[model samples]
Target: MSEKTSTTRRTMLQGIGASLAVGGFSGLTTAAEAEWTTAKTGTDSSLYDVEYTNAGAYAVGAGGVVLERGPTQWTKIVDGGPTGNGNSLYGSDVTDDGDALWFVGSSGAIGEYAVRTGNLNDHSAPMDNTNNYNDVAVTGETGSANVYVAGDSGKIYYSFENGETGTWNYVTPGSGSAIQAIDFHGPRSGHAVDGNGKVFATDDGTTWNPVGLQDANVNFYGVDSDGDGEATVVGGGGMVFHLAESQWTADSTGDKSLLDVEVEDGDGYVVGGGGTVYSVDTTAAKFDELAGSWTAEATPVGQNLKAVVRGPNGAPDVTVGAGGTVLEK
Candidate 1:
């Protein structure tokens, strides 16, 4: 197991004997009515990422702006993030228990925000290197989760003790090529993609081994791991790669570069450039091709969608991106 198992936000609906719900894209004669509403977070700063956990929905981006979606609308929770320097926040993830949200970005700025209380903790610039950090993932209970930060300097930073000072270390997952995305399915296992068309897996959170994609030449952007042997990698040119039975298969959904992907129990969502949205279903036992499993969903805005999470009983409960663009389906 590496970087997130089948127990995601919609893990309940993905349980055995339960019907996994998928979304309907309007203008397509396939599924639901494709109902999407543009949401306002009241900021023009680009929203780099979004997450939907049991705790709630969160969006973070440029200028250290963080927004939390309430029952009525989205509200700004942090003005300049934890750094107070206005550095851009690139990516974020909730703890395994969904009690805290951790975000990382420019100048190695990292912060942990308490979900229930508006409390924010500064945990930035570990190892004294202020290089930009790209994305983050946390595993374990809220306060004790293991922290993993992907760096633009081609290193992966880890802290086993809740990201406290002096507890962090770094590793270059593959050729020091700027790890683009990281996610964990179990407490110690997950996978990472790089800007050089490579994928790496780590079961112990410290030691990493190259997985595949050696012959490709596209920038690997986002990854969603169901296990070490079962995961999804989406990247340049709308490519979607799946790992199953220790073998990898590939397919392209469109021409846009996919920025982020998240899936649980065979249901998932992928977002990218041009506000491209894709609904995923990996329940079929296909041995070769990986096409037709993804359906295009309508985009309410043209801004490039940076990240996505499984929504309430469907795909893309929320997505945030360029210009603070948000969509709720």
Candidate 2:
């Protein structure tokens, strides 16, 4: 498939599922009013992703709106750009030290928020500006500089210079499928998923090789790893796969279309269509179907949860999705 077509299909699926969760925005409604507190983001735009930093938290969504959690309340950071519905922010990631923040969006738009420097730089045009940038992954924690961007048509870009030099080198092509999500486990080791249900692994964030999933043909929308070879991927048809050693163990919830998965405290939590979130045990090296048994957890909200992350400190996990909803459990 072509790059534009692949990315459009991926985005359309997410938009359709999430739209069905809520008919329309009704002033920031949560499934369980008491379970999750609404952040009062003001706008009713659909929020795609959120990230927590040591300084605070940030959420990005449609209309290029970005909400920053302040000491007392959530504030919108000025983008100083367009004010239409076409400008949307999809994915975001914060640096290990919490000083640097980055986000990617429609038409390959890239944004960076420098905490100490108090600067918001919009780098919308990339080498391939026509494609939508689906996800962004940064490497550091031990103080290194590398950023990876994944998008339509098996496209992947990397820059050792933190993408500040206006040079994003291309990685070797894959199956030419739209890479929906990408995550890093360590400085170099990482895994990514495409719209064709295929998985790719990289040791240095450039060269990539496909890992087999037997005969699975469902699209994989989200993925996360333990930094080791083991990873949990979720997608359409309630599909979930655990990659252990080199083999893939596939399972499903038989209902909701799983959108995102996160590995936390030896447990894997997945969120997706109809606000469904399932937790599975993954402490072992090799996972069995019985061992990877999953149970549905109570969702704080009913809107299709597009993304989830471990809450700040030891608090509850946070989930964000349709109609400007932000829930902390």
Candidate 3:
């Protein structure tokens, strides 16, 4: 998802008081079970997003820097990535099989990296549009994943044939509001969020419908479209909005804007602000025994966090943020 919020929106978030915690999720343990560990990335460039796959943990950021987390440490695998012209990468996702990683960013820069190999496939600027891409989601195995890209111009550009040049198409979910994030749970089913407080879902990847977040005043920067009626949307003022079918619930974890989130299998992670990290338990909160499902964990840095993703295997969730700060929770 996109990293920086607009100046006008920032003011609105600061002025409007956040509401009480909303009802969602089941209770689960965090913080006590594990702590966040800052990994040394060996660079100071801001890291905007991270994705965990079977191949490894990869991060993309400023100047198109791509990082890989190994057994020993984090290393810069690519400099001036895909475009090789210093276009910052803002969003990324892995294929269903977790074999390839695709990233989208400034100047319509889009590229796919074979996780097992070092090969980078350039798929930038489909249809000759140079708009910035905020986020992306793929819904199939490597080499065949349907690529859905969320553009900052409030459009969704997609390709069914793995982003092949002529196979791409575009659709605007809202009235030209910048689409900050897009996530898919099936081959053609998923959700997206825009800068204008709009939430949209699509069953066929072309026709989008307003699913939730009705009359919202805050902008949503991230979305985890788990299923038809289940999603976690995070945005300004650390707000979290959850959709349980047609009902929508709202709450705030803190005052800092939540830039990104990922929830799956009843567990997830959220990150934002300077060193802000949240462990989300999507299981126990449904029982009403747990009042709030979010738990804040301490971090080792002060850089503004950008994006987060689930960990591979039994690894802790990985979050990337400003100044290239990476943390394992």
Candidate 4:
């Protein structure tokens, strides 16, 4: 999934009213209200990936469970598919039109659901169940499209057309690594991060080249590009890297294990283990702890949050592991 930055802007306008002095009086009313309000859907089950579709918000998690949020609450759409026991749904992304949603999880499970038609198709059969697929990215174009799925053992699979059977191909960019996240800023520019603290990028999605980092101890879990070939990657040990001037530079945030990083409204937020969340000022190359910071908002569920996304209603929604946990801010 692309690390999207919340770009919401707030402004205030003031107005003055005139009053009649002698006989009649006139009054003006002024009120201030927030433009957006965020609220948690309130579910106990572990949610791995949360995405907004034309139908509504959908969250996928362990046990092949997929939850959809309606006008009022969340409902279980699908539960316990053929792959019964899986750790978690690792990746999810919506189609360009928001009419389709794709999800990949442990045990090489890959599936897509039609938001408008209630159609669900499992594409895992062609994968041969060799490795668990941990991430998926869909191109912006529709019909006869391209989709990339990354997984354990440095496996990267591609589908030139919609998953209508027999359109899958494997493209190995690296060896002996687990790809945890992937993102395509455009149809041609894309990036992937692996468990071995390495990043591979490609202009056409078919060919990839390694983009070395400064810290070998940092295993990047997520990456996002700005569609102009410039991108940012974030991962373990509070490490951040920016692709600029045809090079990657490390942007450290004072040694925090940042699990997920997202950009919204031109600002970046990195969330990680120990309830650590840092807000980065990209222009200044500096970050500060959020109001509550780590350890303050750490929930009773002491799990290492693995991934996070901007919530459906514009809040920061995070997913953690150690027992499949989900939190919203």
Candidate 5:
């Protein structure tokens, strides 16, 4: 997602009203088990997004910085940019098998990191549009990879060869709004959300169709699919929408503009401005706005969080955002 929110830090801190506390995990010993730990990511660049790969957790941020979390610490693996002033990497994704890592950013910068050989390369956007590449989603297994990179002006690029050779094909046509994020749960199924509160879905990733909401003016910042025909979308004004049964239902998330959301197993996590982080237990076949399923977790800092991803190997969830903050829980 892009830096669409211009509210300052002080204003955001003052807007953090009462947070809701949901029940703990079943059979958990204590409430302390639901806390987050601050992980030192070294650089102070604001990390826009994160993804898990075989090498570890990789975070992309300002100045084209990419931090890799090792067993003990986070290393600044990639710093500076193809340009001298450094580019802003807005979104990233890794293959399920952890064979490839892809990061998309400003000026159509696409960085591909190979896990096994430790080789990193740069790929240009389709037709070298130079528009800001905001989000990316990778589908298929390791050997056969299809990467979808979305950006401003409703531009979406697809690469069938892991985007290693700087080749791309435009997929989403005539979309003028900025696509903030994209996700794929099945090989031929995926979703993309744009800045104009529009949702696009593709069964083959080559053709796209618009999905309607009750309201068409809410700007969605992030979206994720659980790979079971269930998907969640979050956006400005703390909007939470669940897509199930071929319908969209508006869910409650208070008044915080949720920046990103991720669903794994039967649970989900959302993060947003003013240090808002929520844990959602999605048990209802259909999402309920008033259901007692949302819990507000404590944040170490009051900075705005941009994106979040589930941790690997039972590790804590990783969140990144303003002031170069990184948290694990």
Candidate 6:
């Protein structure tokens, strides 16, 4: 097998039959929703990605497992057996209609699960088993819904029909690096970041071109848009790039590798290795590290966090590697 295939298989097998549990934290249950907490069916495996929906919050991780969080608590929806096989669900995005959720993982596994009907469907049977789907982005364009997925070996797949049933054609953006995350803020504007610290943008999601940054040593792991053609990309070595005036600007925090970033309430949060979290002041061009600032909030766990998302109330919800850790702050 090739290097890509070998890496993909190793990620999947390492997460198989792993136990997943939520512990080592407190204040999870509010007084009003205590009855809905179901802790018996938790998985001890690592959860790679998570997204929020009208139905609730869904998190996917190793071993093909899916967990759902309702108004009060979390419940396991799918188990690791023949279906999941411990494939690392690295990226996920919910549709605008709040009806469907799409996840991509190792071996090009593209699984779609319906939120209302509880239907789980897999769409990876066509690929040659060499592709590993890593990230997904949804576009709410008029008259046509588009979903783009990026993966290993410099592969990018797109679906115009919302990934229901259609040909997922591949597009090579000339990066020659694995696309780690994608974000579409509007119908015609979006951006994607790769492992080589490069950013690609497209107005129509069809024709993509590179947006040069002053520094190219930053390995961007996640990106998010503001629905106004502006975006922020975060990655390794405390690198943060923002799009303003049709140009990308670089800002360094002088910290460890940043794994993920998210924007909420006109503010941004960048999370990464060594319990590093930085909050960007949108009005300013730099990140402030003053005491008692939001960025100074230390992650309770120090296990190299992989992803972070802003909760409904703008609180930080984070996930880390190894031991299936989930942190809410």
- lDDT against the true structure, per candidate, is 0.78, 0.67, 0.78, 0.60, 0.71, 0.61
TM-score of 4: 0.75
Model 3, runs deviating above 4 Å: 1-33, 285-291
Across 1-329, the per-residue lDDT of candidate 4 in tens digits comes to 12222221110000001111111111211112211122234445556666655564577877777777543445677776325454357778776656678888877788888877888877774556457777888765335446888878687888878755778777777776888788876665678888887778888778888877736676787776554435677876677776654555566665657666555334545666765555543333312222122222334445565665543333224343334454444
Say which prediction, candidate 2 or candidate 6, comes out ahead on lDDT. 2
Q: Count clashing residue pairs per candidate.
A: 10, 0, 7, 8, 0, 9
**Per-residue C-alpha lDDT of model 1 across residues 48-108, encoded as one tens digit per residue:** 8887554457899999999987645677889787979988899998776566889999998
- Please provide, for model 3 over 1-329, each residue's C-alpha lDDT reduced to its tens digit, 9 standing for 90 to 100: 11211221111222221210111101311223477777778999999888766555789999999998765567898889798988999999877666688999999999999978889999999999989999998877688778999999999999999998899999999999999999876788889998889899898989999986767787788988766767788898889888764568787898998999877655677788978888767555342212257899898888888998664434456788888788775
Greater TM-score among 2 and 6 belongs to 2
lDDT for model 2 comes to 0.67
Query: Candidate 4 regions off by >4 Å?
Result: 1-45, 81-87, 141-143, 254-256, 281-302, 311-325
Error of 1 at 10 (Å): 6.8
RMSD of each: 4.8, 9.4, 10.3, 9.8, 9.6, 10.0
> Which residue pairs overlap in candidate 2's backbone?
none
Question: Using alpha carbons, what is the TM-score of model 5?
Answer: 0.84
Q: What tens digits encode model 6's per-residue C-alpha lDDT throughout 211-288? A: 766366766788875534367777776877767556566677767887778764345467778667676444443222
Ranking by TM-score: 1, 3, 5, 2, 6, 4
Model 5 lDDT tens row, 1-329: 11111221111212221110122112212224567767776788999998766555678899998887665557787786434348888988876556677888898788777866877766755666788988988865565678888878787888777665656678654458888888876655778887777787887778888776637467899997543345688888887887765667676678889999976544668899899998876555544332346688888888999999765334456889987888877
Q: What is the per-residue lDDT of model 2 for residues 76-172, given as tens digits with 9 covering 90 to 100?
A: 7744322233568878776655566777877777777775566776656667465777888876531345777887757887777777656677774
lDDT-wise, the better of 4 and 6 is: 6
Q: In model 5, which range of ten residues has the least summed lDDT? A: 16-25
What's the TM-score of every candidate structure? 0.88, 0.81, 0.87, 0.75, 0.84, 0.78
